[model samples]
Target chain A: MDIDMSLVDWSRAQFALTAMYHWIFVPLTLGMTFMIAIMETIYVRTGKEEWKRITKFWGKLFGINFAIGVATGIILEFEFGTNWSNYSWFVGDIFGAPLAIEGIMAFFMESTFIAIMFFGWNKVSKKFHLTSTWLVAIGANLSALWILVANAWMQSPVGTVFNPDMARNEMVNFWEVLFSPVAINKFLHTISNGYVVSAIFIIGVSAWFLLKKRNIVFAKKSILVAATFGLVTSIFLALTGDGSAYEVAQKQPMKLAAMEGLYDGKTEAGLVVVGALTPGKEAGDDKDAYIFKIEVPKMLSWLGYRSGDAFVPGVNDLVYGNEEQGLISAEEKIERGKVAVQTLTEYKTAKDEGDMETLAQLSPLFDRETSEGQEFYENYFRYFGYGYLNAPGDIIPNVPMVFYSFHIMVGLGFFFILFFFLVLWFTVKNKIDSKKWLLRLSLLTMPLAFIASQAGWIVAEVGRQPWVIQDLMPTVAAVTRLDASAVQLTFVLFAIIFTTLLVAEISIMVKAIKTGPKENEGGK
Target chain B: MNRRNIFARVLFFYVDGFRNLSGWGKKLWIIILLKGIVIFVLMKLLFFPNVLNQNYDTDAERSNHVLETLTKSK
Candidate 1:
């Protein structure tokens, strides 16, 4: 079959573009909802008009961001059907469940409480209003949790079985899929990053007020809350990020190798601190990929494998296979994947011809308790996506892109931690207002935070290229067989629509921020 | 009788609410609408073809092809 590479590329671009746009608003909503809740909680506890003003002020911004987030988010969910109809049918049974649950359980919860939190200020009791705000925060994070669980399943397809009759993966054990270590770690890490984004936003906006010498008391109090929250979550982000890397090393060694720009397998690989890539470096080029490199000694192995001298397979090792590193070649995996595919086809043909005996024989291949089943799935079925590839080099992701994005994200992450620490310290020392340089720096952090967040996503999504669901289906096979032009056209359309909405959102938010918090307008 | 009274009358009755917008505002609003229509309505109607529905007449056909792709050795 002739695969439409253009269709696959456009479909991927469309999805990635929508996902990125959706994320810009989502992280803010996720982080700021809780910040607003915390502020409202203080308002309830202290009964201070000042605290109430801060809560109301941030609450207004949250509402603006949330409205646009909802709009962008709905498009992403629908794109699974519109842009990737094949992916929808292929993994819909298992994938759709979590998404549906997110909608029914989490989205509704968030939207409902948000209404009450915003509009019920004067209507509800103080304690009740605070409860509603907290509920909204919980609801938003719970939404993230379910969606990330779905995404992690794609990254590490667990507790699911391929049914040839349905031509799809079906969940046998919901618990395993929901509670997979990948899902849990991703949820924690992603939401923590959201917290960081929110803290940065709060600090940046407050810094603007400080620079202008307007709303000094309000800005100082906000800085105190945001700084503390940012510091705590930034630490969690680091820890969870470590867990995420470990999971990637275990499940997707190719992705890890690409991220580090590692070409040769090593016993104890140093994690790259910074590196410059040689131009026009191909995956199989004899020359070194990195022109000049700086790395932390033995850190990659220690971080990825919890050992100082663990064997880590590089891109070349994965492509060529390294017996010493216990790495199998992509060629071998592809061969096995073909066999798995052939067997399934034969199984289907037999079933079509009413061959019950053949069905009985094929049944053991899927049976978890059987040794033969375990060997077949663990060896061959696990690398089923390789069956669709034409060359072993197709297994290599864009190394330079992944490597740079990873470094940028990590660098910004550490920078944020230090920034938050300084801000918090200054706030405690009563020198926050006087530190004009720090205030200006904080104001600059908002865009930097956004860039870091986008880069992190690019690493995760682009680093796992060619596979919509890792090792199960290549993106070529997963896309809807549409006219490429049709997809390209719609891609442009969505881009325009989303951009326009984003501009409107920004304009309204800036106007609101410029109008300082009202005094004595408690609840009303 | 007054300018404010006349402005309110036009705002309440006009289709584009031109009285509510300045001269530049009217032009910008029209451009935004035109762009929105071209993108959301015209492009979707013309270019958003249903490839899946066209290629496979039935779910069984699509499923069979997918299964074959997975199982057929390259």
Candidate 2:
């Protein structure tokens, strides 16, 4: 029954590595598929050969990116069973449904129409091919939606009941899980981030073409579409980001505390406008961890609760109880969780012995029909993850990592807004292709977009800390009992293979772009 | 004919397909197959350890241990 800490760490590291690599291509695929569709739609409407050429060119790049994304994504799906077999078993009852549904509904939709969009140019009717292109875009996004819903459920588990006998969480209300506020906000936020990344990518590459003046007209038109799209999605990304913060504040206050590096309870805690934290600072003991910090007065409260004066419990307050915030200590939750765990065990033994009295008493704690039963269930069942914890401090996530990642992501988000605005303005002035410095800046934003996307994931995932499913299971308890060396070997293998695929993908994309769109035989 | 002949025919085609490849293509295919085997079989057989299932032997025993730990109040 001993949990190997090293195995858990290595497994987590492996998943993170694969996920980050998978993410590099996914956002672009999500963004560019729709861009190509838009171009084709224009071609369909205007009957312009130029629009068709543009669509075909971008579609080529999209196909290359899509292939590697599919390859890495397949690996990720299997790793769930291979590395995290325990977590797969524990929550598979509820978790497996969305993934399976995604494969049936979204993946099928994408993979089927993708061929038509790529190779059916002269074979199919223009209208039908256009429809297929749009379908590919819709399918890719729908796939993202389902995957995010699954991840969001892990963050805020809903519509599920704990089945002690089966030793797993089972879905009770699929609708609740699908439509939970967290899932919806996560979908909106994540997809908008994708759109913004794609827009930046287009603008950057178009800037390169403009600098060389190879495809000036095509580059300008592409920049116009991407910049406008980027600007709108950037604004939406910021708004949904606020909604995400509010959800975290409500469902995972400790994560919020880690993200902001808030260590002391306050009624109106100021938001860290810009901050630098001291290295190796511990919460509860190190009060002044911020080496340099700027604050916006009462902004955190207003953002989190829609009120400027609402009490927000800090990290220390959650680890050690805060009376004002009505927060109980993690230690207290551990004790309650232990009771719940013990009660279930005894109940199992009684059932084995055919003791009806003990069964009746224990049944109320698991039942949710009556008011008393619901209260008991809420009080003890909610803290189930705490039972596995040895100390209250184990609940605290790596604050410095979450804090820096959040700031970096937000900073880059604002920068993108400004960058897109300038690009759009210059295009209107007829100077977009003429400005060499601005083109270089636009080109630089391509990598920055990826960095921001990765940072966003780090903030969301690492901020959740020990819990894989918040309050239900700690990651240490959820990893498969595999040897650390096995995980390390697989991790290295995945790293090498994925890196090779990434290099190949980039080289092919560069070559495609260098070749440019094929000339139309009959038209300019 | 028989199952063995059918298998041999399939294997022959697979090997011939590789043999027909250019030098670089052949090398690339070999590298890919070697990596696949190392990842799928050799690594798993030599390194991957499954102690959780081994230790408890049964679900009932594991559940019992977890319950005992939880109920043991300080």
Best by lDDT: 1
Q: DockQ for each of the predicted structures, in order? A: 0.14, 0.09
RMSD values, in order shown: 6.9, 5.9
lDDT (CA) per prediction: 0.83, 0.81
Among all windows of 10 consecutive residues in model 1 chain A, the one with the lowest summed lDDT is A67-76
lDDT of 2 by residue, A1-524 (tens): 25778898999999899899999989998999888889888889999888887787788678777765664565566676667656666685577898888878765675458756754666568999899999998888998888899999999999988766556678999999999999999999999999999999989988988998888888888888899999999999999999999999999998888888888868888899799987777767855868999999998998788888988888899999986668899999999877776777777778778999998888777767767668867888788778778899989999999999999999999999999999999998999987899999998899999999999999999999799999988887777656798788888977887798788778867877787766772142
The C-alpha stretches of model 2 lying farther than 4 A from their native spots are A352-356, A521-524, B1-74
C-alpha lDDT of residue A11 in model 1: 86
Q: Label model 2 with its docking quality class.
A: incorrect
lDDT of 2 at B6: 82
